[model samples]
Target: MLQLKVIQEVITLILFVVFSLVFFKNETLKWNPIIGMCFLVLAAYFIFKK
Candidate 1:
């Protein structure tokens, strides 16, 4: 379970970075809210994780 938590954190972080890059690279991509949401969900998930 602890391993799962760590993995989730890592994955979420990766996703955040990827999304930010994509948003930056593409003007058509509106990633503000999506990035915000990903971070928020990751934070909540980790905070509540055992």
Candidate 2:
């Protein structure tokens, strides 16, 4: 249950950023957000690692 929650949160955040970039033209992708997304991806990787 905990693992699922963590995975979902990470995926949701990543998807949110992606969708925002795709759907919102005024929203620009910055370095900070990109770095943050990299961290989120790392977190997701660790969560799924056995």
Candidate 3:
């Protein structure tokens, strides 16, 4: 179960990056997506740190 959670988190992070990159390419306001993802990654890392 723990391993699955870790995998899900990693996949979520990757999707966030890909989504942000694709969004930014076509829209200017997509910066929020990238910033949001960065914060999410930071929070997730700290929260899950062992």
Question: Higher TM-score: candidate 2 or 3?
Answer: 2
Candidate 1 colliding pairs: none
Q: How far out, in Å, is residue 44 in model 2? A: 1.7
| Model 3 global lDDT (CA atoms, 0 to 1) | 0.71
lDDT of each: 0.69, 0.84, 0.71
2 or 3, greater by lDDT:
2
Query: In candidate 3, what residue range of length 10 has the lowest lDDT sum?
Result: 25-34
Worst 10 residues of 1 by lDDT: 25-34
- Model 3 agreement with the true structure over 1-50: per-residue lDDT tens digits: 76567668767878766787697786554677668767766766776788
| Candidate 1 per-residue C-alpha lDDT over 1-50 given as tens digits, one digit per residue, 9 for 90 to 100 | 76667667667766876887787776454688568667767766776678
Error of 3 at 45 (Å): 14
* Total residue pair clashes for candidate 3: 0
Return the candidate ranking by TM-score, descending.
2, 3, 1
Model 3: runs farther than 4 Å from truth? 26-50
